[model samples]
Target: MYQKKLVGVFGDPVDDNPSVVIEQVAFDYMKLPMEYLTIQVKKGDLQAAIEGLRAMNFTGINITMPHKIDVLQYLDYVADDAKIMGAVNTIYVKDGKLYGENTDGKGFMRNLRNGNVPTKGKNVVLLGAGGVARAISVELANAGVKHITVVNVIKEEGERLVELLNSKTSVEATFVFWDHKYSVPDKTDIVVNATPIGFVNKEEKPNIVYESIHPQMVVCDVIPNNMNTLFLEEAKKIGCKTFHGMQMLVNQGAIAFELWTGLEAPVQVMLEALAKVYGD
Candidate 1:
């Protein structure tokens, strides 16, 4: 007995996207006239899907994976941060114009703040130079991080990310070869895994060394499919504060929610919903 407002996530292989459940739970808790879905849009069909969302008066939609970069071409306006990262994960239509923004970095920062992890004047050892790494590194630099050492299997990509972070921001950044062993430098305050290493298969082992993690640092992984990534488990074993992958997933969705409805997102509620789905 209410009006219907449409919102959803767009990506290939989106059938298991947890955003669908968490977002719908928030909408229901707030009693908002909204429904969330996981729309599977193949790479070739991205443009048509975006156009359809706008033409049909959809509120806003979250972009993911292969579409994050391609979807930027269709937006009428892109936020400065999103343009800087060369990716867009959230899109909202307002005044007949579609606007794009990247909430992944901000979402990760919010997760850190919620967990009481400090960023200013800290050293970070980041794994991977992909999209999630780019977003997080940009945000960390903006947050006054002292220095960052990025490790990646691809030397070119890693150097590119370091150059971008060093040239564009105040953070001193460097690239290191990732041998998939315990090579983390001393005095590092944060460690992040932004790669897809752990998502390949259940039998696949973690790329980062468990013994190298110090108890004084914070370890984070961007893979959300598995809540207890081996990296996190290793960090916990060492008594280091660990941030789960789902934290960023839920926080990013909450940021998108705030952008769409202009309402304070119930972050804890969203976290609970995610835990229910992933069985935390």
Candidate 2:
């Protein structure tokens, strides 16, 4: 019998994180000798947390919240994509060395591709300038998006993201200071709410001009637990196709599962597990 491998997600306020559930579900389904854990490492103890994982010979770890950016310094290697995004959400151990990767953006890109949503030369608008937004923007740029507009309530953060995109990639990027009911530009091809506004309250969403959503455009939100957020609902009311965060969550989880175990992830099984947990 193979020795059980230990995997865990480390973060403060870790109670609500779904990674443990989905990852453990995948491991159970595959009958892998692995244990998934939720570790509450306070922000100040992240360095110690990394060292502890190293000492424990853990198979892998998922970093979340305040640790994503800081955990980079402790890892042995970080993928180029995670370096560009300035965050690392997933890490796997190989040759006893830690490797960091950002699956958030790739998850969105994969979900879009899976749904036959094209990003090549498409004009995209992001609804926030947070960590997930950074990851998605880099992936969008690499996928040949023609333009990106980041809208945020904070001018500095939004501008920083736009600057990173414009300088680091060929994608033409701009930042918009979000105040009042921001009108979606007529030419927008895809609109994504990368913010957390809808995570807690399904009825609350980003303050965008819902009437401006065109039926031809694709709409997305990143709030996983509350999959049916008001943002996507409003887009549907406008006759536009929309989807919430379940796909992104499961896709990202699946990616991590593959990287850690070197086996094909049961994507559908993982999706069902998350859906049941969220009552989706």
Candidate 3:
């Protein structure tokens, strides 16, 4: 029997996340003598928290929220993907060195490919200008997407994302100011909700008009819980294919688990864990 190893997620507001609960389910399913825990990290204490994680000898830590970008400066090394995305959502310490990686973009790609959603030469409309949006933009552009249009209530943020993408890849990317009252472009092949608009208790749901979404369009939301987000529901009503963020979460977690343990992640076990926590 293998001795139990420890792993977990760190962030404020984590107590309410289904991901934290699902970690427990993973432990039970694997029966590999592993334990998982969630830590509530206060603002401005990310470095200290990371140092404490090292001291505790945690196998790995999942970064979240404001800490993702902030923690980058503290890492000894970062993967190229995380560097390009400007964020880190997973960290692991090895040989007295802290390494960072951003699994969000690759995880999203995995979900997209696994679900058979086409991306090559497709026109994608991405909602929001935050870290998740940044990751998705880089990944899609690199995957040979024909065009990407980003929309955000904050014009400056949207423009900034477009500039970053243009500098990184030769893909045609543009930014547009979003007026919540209007419908999104009908020419879009994929619509992604990367903002928190559809999160639990978030006041405004995604503002895209459902009537404009065609049956051939693919709609995806980065919000995991409540799989039937208003954005997804509206898209579904229009006969559009839809995806929740749960697959992204699982794929990212699997990568992090592999980094921490150097063992192939039991993906089925992780999926079972998520199903137990969120219900299939």
* lDDT computed for candidate 3: 0.81
- Candidate 1 on 1-280: residue-level lDDT in tens? 5558899888866556788877888899999999987888889999999999877779999998888998889999998778878899999888878999998898889889988888999999998999999999999999999999999988899999999998888999999887757477768999998888667564454566567677898888888767787777778889988887787988998899998899988888998888877744
The C-alpha lDDT values of all candidates are 0.86, 0.90, 0.81
Measured by C-alpha RMSD in angstroms, how accurate is candidate 1? Answer: 2.0
Which candidate wins on TM-score?
2
Ranking by lDDT: 2, 1, 3
**The 10-residue segment with the lowest total lDDT in model 3:** 18-27
In angstroms, how far off is 251's CA in candidate 3?
A: 2.2
Candidate 2 residue runs with Cα over 4 Å from true position: 1-3
Q: Per-residue lDDT tens digits of candidate 3, residues 1-280?
A: 5556777777776556665655556556666666777777886788798888778777788888878888889989998768888889888889978999988888788889989988889999999999889998898988889999999999999999999888878679898898665576878899999998766563457776668888889998887655677788888888988988877778777777778777776777776667666643
Task: Assess every candidate by TM-score.
Answer: 0.92, 0.95, 0.88
Clash count per candidate: 0, 0, 0
lDDT accuracy of residue 133 in candidate 1: 93
> By TM-score, how accurate is candidate 2?
0.95
Q: Which scores better on lDDT, 1 or 3? A: 1
Per-residue accuracy of model 2 over 78-169 as CA lDDT, tens digit each: 99989988899999999989999999999999889988999999999999999999999999999999999999999999999999999889
